[model samples]
Target: MAMGKTPGSSDDEGDSAGFAEINITPLTDVMLVLLIIFMVTSTVITQQGPGGGTKTGLKVNLPKGGSADVTARTTDISVAVLADGRFVLAGNVVAEAELKQAFDKAKEQNPDTVVIVQADEGVSHGTVVQVMELAKQAGLGQLAIGVREGN
Candidate 1:
């Protein structure tokens, strides 16, 4: 089982057997690297929005009704994610491919904009993530997930 030594290679008589040793150090190293990477990413993604390094120029609609009313701050920009994964920027429906350009323009205009992510109940989580990435790329700082008051 030692390196540079093969039991069967010596005796071509075809009746020799050699055991192999499995080293797990490489696997362990890879796993540790992955863990460290995830840990760093976790720390980096602890928050969302403009002050959070993500653009907030969306004025998406919120799901109707809740335990109470959510006070809409005049200073915040609302970005809504529809059930079909469309982005609503500033009370307007922004095309999927056009989102980045729109966000870029918004970012150029206002760097302190606050973003509100209002996802429809039926929308997939992936859709939200895509929009969030776009927001981050736009260099926004304050990001908010608009949640209605719980009953």
Candidate 2:
């Protein structure tokens, strides 16, 4: 008896069989989901800083200066001296002793971190100098005084 040719069979002399092509749709979908997850988490992380301190946006009337303007870095630590002589660090009211600890922690994390003292116009010069000295003792070299632009 003669063997008959089968449809889609490798034995067929004139026919060729090959593996099916791979489908990447599922892989693409998984990658897109992961990307979206990372984007959402990163936004939440930036909203809350390392110590969970958000900018208090404290109102302080900065002293005016005529010197050349310099753009402040976002990484710079802000030490706000209110007109009432209260020290606000990282948006929280901090005592003089706590100020030094905060500066030390910041310097330990980044040795080049700059301390920017934003003292109100009514704040005493001595208070501002006190914060600067504390920052200097914390091993931080860069220090800046926040001032308003224009005269």
Candidate achieving the largest TM-score: 2
RMSD of each: 14.6, 7.6
- Per-residue alpha-carbon lDDT of candidate 1 for residues 48-135, written as tens digits (9 for 90 to 100): 3333232334433455555534344544556678777877765467786677776676688778666667887777889878877887
TM-scores for every predicted model: 0.49, 0.61
Tens digit per residue, CA lDDT, model 2, 10-119: 65355543443578999999999999999998876664433513233677898888673545555668888999999987668899999999888888788878788889
lDDT values for all models: 0.65, 0.77
| Prediction 2 global C-alpha lDDT | 0.77
In model 2, pairs of residues that clash are: none
Give the range of the ten consecutive residues with the poorest summed lDDT in model 2: 47-56
